[model samples]
Target: MLKEKGLLGNIGVQVVIAMCVGTLVGAMMGHSASMFAPLGSIFIHLIKMLVIPLVAVAIISGAAGLGSSHSAGKVGFATLGFFGFTSAVAVALALFMGEVFQPGMGVDLTGVEGLFSNVYADKGDLPSFWATVLGMIPTNVFQSLNEANILQILVFCLFFGIALSKLEKDRRDPLINGVNAIVDAMVWMINVVMKIAPLGVFGLMADAVGTFGFSALMVVFKLFLVYVGAILIYGFVFYPLMIKVFSKTSPVKFLSVMKKPQAVALSTASSMATLPVTMEACEEELGVKNSTASFVLPLGATINMSGNAIYYGLVAIFFAQMFNIDLGMSAYLAIIVTSTLGAVGQAGVPGPSFLVVAVLLSAGIPIEGLPLLFALDRIFDMIRTALNITGDAACAVIINDMVSKDPSHAAEEKVQNA
Candidate 1:
């Protein structure tokens, strides 16, 4: 859109500049830098206003489009399979890196021991399998919408979208068109909002840095370093490989176009808040089908949290090493399973990942040192959130390619040609 405006016109470039300046300003001003926070808050609220409705309408439109085809069920399964597989791989990689680096060993906890707390101990109990399933099925759809309950919203929209697709074309087309119109309107609004993203990003970065300086990081610097390396490996190495093998996209181009969404993800640290940018990046820049992107991206944002899986696994191992607890083969398996599942169960919003608590508890790791990490969770959350959105886009691109190449699609095109 800003092609005529040169390099600085690009949203991604602007955000990066804003972020760097914000960081310097924050470091200089310290806590007082929070004065710019309203810019960030206003921008986040604007994005939040659009997210629930956009997700609902977009998914319904996507599902209906796919449901009209023979590949709906295939698309659904493939997306879920991709999320599960990537998440499992992420956890395993984190575990491997943790064991190799041993970020938790030789930690002088003398002064920092006071930061440990049992406040989060009670939050570690994971819901039963059946309960988690049941919770996804909302008893009140409107209430779910009001609360912005993403999983429940996804459940209803997918079901409703598929049902809409079953109607006669004369009936379905009008509703689908109406839904598409809403999506287009939302997209336009998002574009308008994005013009101010640089200012908003500046506010967010300044506030985060000013409030939580680099001092807290010194305590667990090794753990933080390892965490970032895992994210980079996953984002730059693993996802690019997946795209190269499974889709037509070049890894370079995909990464290039992704800078905008990744910047927003870093600043917001909430996949849900960054949903609009991710969707636009996939559909416009990556050439993913709206039918594929709308369905897959939102679902990915809600549940496909391979980034969090890595964090949970690494943190579990870190604490295990710190406390001198020997993790057996069973414990490793538990960490893998728990971390993967826990990552999926987490909400996409920015917050302290108490799910890490569950992962630690599952592997018999200590949770006492968790508060130390929590203090620096913002930085950790920002890095991982960027990776999370990248995973979502990769799955969308790969799945779109799969659907296009399906035999059923080929036959259907031939039938139309005839």
Candidate 2:
């Protein structure tokens, strides 16, 4: 029993061991970290490759399905509410956790100034709030499509879905049916890609271990614990309470159905990349209507990053602490506001959270405290990504419960079993 538990339930333990071994060899031989860089790059690329098509098809199909079932207003409100509530909760929880723990309290920040200064050099000017809002409107539809701008894609989808909802019943069926077929095919392709995901995860993990070793692991350990603890509180405590109050569902059961998809998100570390699996789990396993699942999950993948938002707060406090700087109440408030907006502003851009951290620091705070945190971003990113995806799935379940025709019957079979 002990052996099986250690072997099957503790991949993180094995990863630590690998990191120790790799670091010892590299240190002794004076080897370059570049030797292990390729694996991480390849894993990131594989995820990026799947992102564009997966998002486009998922959003389009979801939007179209929403149009077929309900008024555009209902669909729009539900999506907005889910994103808004989750984002608010995420930011609040992260701030609370950061204040209580102070993970960066004792870290030394000497000699790290150049690392952040160089990293943030070309990040350019931080856009104003109104400008960021304006940028959400795509100047050119095809250009936005080619650029894979998620907010732009979402804007287009909102209009497209509303138009589809307005179509006569007789005219809509054939179009919806055709799009559904294409979506089905695309989902299948995503599954085929997923079979390779474990390999990608393994390579990424191995390379991270090989390059950074135990010292990096310690930094990651601190970030990981803080981030994971915040997620558990949110996922298990906060979200469940919201479920009870607003949706009247079993949060325990909701989380159970979410486990498989959460695992997929952690392994992939990309919410958009995990959408195909999330959609399947919500529709088939959790029994959310396709219309609701399609609309909510894709939008959640793009914008609903509860975990990432939390990480942003925690890391911002973390860097402040490392620099022996006091982030007064005002600063914490600023972080809460900025991180929430930053999460939205940087959606669909690779590692934008880290870049946003640099922006926040440069805007004031301590610009030099970033590299102390960078060594562990990849590790916390995996956890944040998983939590983000879980939040998305949980919201889908709650929304489905609200809109189901036979709510109690659907709840009994799905929630109880899940």
Candidate 3:
């Protein structure tokens, strides 16, 4: 039965089953909770181990591929514009959703103290916003690579890609091709690893259920609903309208091109992991120019996290409300600024955004309320990942329309053929 459904299909089914089974079993066998927690931690670490290298290689190779194409500069600017616009819209939507629903009103957090103590202990103090921004520029390339600093890696990739593009064709071709081949192999390896995602997800789900129990879900139900609802609005309404207004392409066609990448994003819950697939889909399936996809998607994945930004802001406010912290206009303004910067500066890895969310919360509200969010973090992480990738693709489409030498030509030809 599982085999008939295919790998990802089975993985999804397994995750649902695991969550249900874990909840029931944990409730029954409370004594065995310790065992399930360690297993889940191990699985999460394994996923974490793959993240830095995968992001570094994928972004570099994607940028290098863009360099091979001739229109790097125009494509780069259009991509920047797309990211800026979409990110702004995402923040707006998050604020709107957070305020309209007020996901944290009347939530009880008295018993949640011990729930996230370990998580809090692991988190260090947050650097100032300017410091975080300044830190993105690597002092030493090797050191940055060793540290797996995503922003530094991205800066290096951009310059290296541009330099490669500026080189003589013969000199650049061999290097670019070699890098591309390695990237392809790495992507294949990732796919193979992801086939075991069900196991990993099962472990993670078991741990969550064991620790929090299903009853704890009711505490944050409103926040969960708001987050999911906001993402859906961004995906269906905001993105399509942007495409129609700015791109001159049918929203339906754009969504079709985006489906596969979006699915990959939801499963992996890492935009960096989904970059290779996203770039490919954008270029081949969506007819986005290679130069555009190669440059835009990778860069966007790193810095253009519209979804994450919104999430951080909403969570900050949610936490404040839960703690009975009255956030005035200044605090809300601080949230908007800090969350936007934090999302861009934070590394695109699992669990890292939570760190940034922690930082934002500390700066804007009381840190004691952080634990409440940790209980529901994984569920929201998956939703945020989906939204992040969807934003990336939507930006790519908008940018593609902007930079196409003749957008009307392609649309007219397609219309005539249809």
Candidate 4:
């Protein structure tokens, strides 16, 4: 859509300009830059509006539509396990990278010391294991949607979707169709929102730089490098190796088919919103079985976030260091578990993936460091979303290969059968 229509037509160029302008203008505007916060907030609100519904319907349709597959249970359980394994490893890698690099070591936090003092006042306390598990099931689905509690929505969708799948074909078709329509409508809305993304980034950058000054930017930049480096290692090295080792499929062919989904994910910074395109590529481009693509990709989008896992690890460590907190071996290990689990429920938005919850749910890490982390969130969200998509595709590829003895012929038969 952003073809050669002149200066305003190119989003990449616009974002670059906005980043530069935001930093320069924010520095010049100083305290007065607070005025631009609302603009950024508007953009976030636009993106947020789509996340819950998009995820709900995407999950419902993807899971519910797996009715005709013979090994739905096997495929389903395998998919979930793959996600858990990959996410655990991703967080571990992040912890290692963060500990080695020390992204926030000696960074000044005094500038934003007071910014997050009250951000989590009511719910800042970390809940116990029982409370955390209970909270996952929303008391009311309507209320969960209103609050944008992703974990709750994911729980509801999983149950509701499986129920839909068990119904007679005629009984389930209408509900699935309705949900699919809503998902499509949401994707359309995302396209509209993305047209104005550069403006949103500008306002967010302005508020961030204006509030914390450039030193925080440097800290965030270092954190950004750590994240990007981890994503590269995971996406390029880890993911392809898994595909090659576990699957008979060519990584080159897999990535070639995945090119569109990866691009869409990076630009939108939302795996949930990019579901349709990703699924299409999986079935049509990659020749993955419908059973594998339907079950694996949807679950992966919500819970199997390699990128979020990495970010969670780094952010936890960075926050701990910023507050002069020393982490014991137990604290470090807890972060690995916390981040892996926390990532399971993290909404695929551009910034701050359940930051409040990660801080509240996990051990260690002061709340005061949130402002610095939030500043560069959008900066990191893109690459991580791409990594997130890569993981999803990898999961599908491996699962498809595992279930099929003859990958090519079986994929074709599954497609025809589906």
Best by lDDT: 1
TM-score of 3: 0.85
The deviation in Å at residue 263 for candidate 1 is 2.6
User: Would you estimate the TM-scores of all the predictions?
Assistant: 0.90, 0.83, 0.85, 0.82
For model 3, the stretches where C-alpha displacement exceeds 4 angstroms are 1-28, 31-50, 65-71, 116-130, 355-364, 406-418
Q: Model 1 over residues 226-311: C-alpha lDDT tens digits?
A: 99999999999999999999999999999998887887787667787677778888988899988888889888988999999999
Off by over 4 Å in 4: 1-17, 33-38, 106-126, 256-259, 319-326, 353-367, 405-418
Error of 2 at 118 (Å): 4.5
Q: Report the lDDT of model 1 for residue 124.
A: 89
Off by over 4 Å in 1: 1-40, 110-114, 196-213, 415-418
lDDT of 4 by residue, 306-402 (tens): 7888887877777776667788888877877777777776766666565444543366566655666666766678778888988898888787777
* Winner on lDDT (2 vs 4): 4
Q: Give the Cα error of residue 195 in candidate 1, in Å.
A: 4.0
Residue pairs whose backbone atoms clash in candidate 2: none
Q: Write down the lDDT of every candidate, Cα atoms only.
A: 0.86, 0.66, 0.68, 0.74
Clashes of each: 0, 0, 0, 0
The per-residue C-alpha lDDT of model 2 at residue 193 equals 55
Model 3, backbone clash pairs (residues 3+ apart or across chains), number: 0
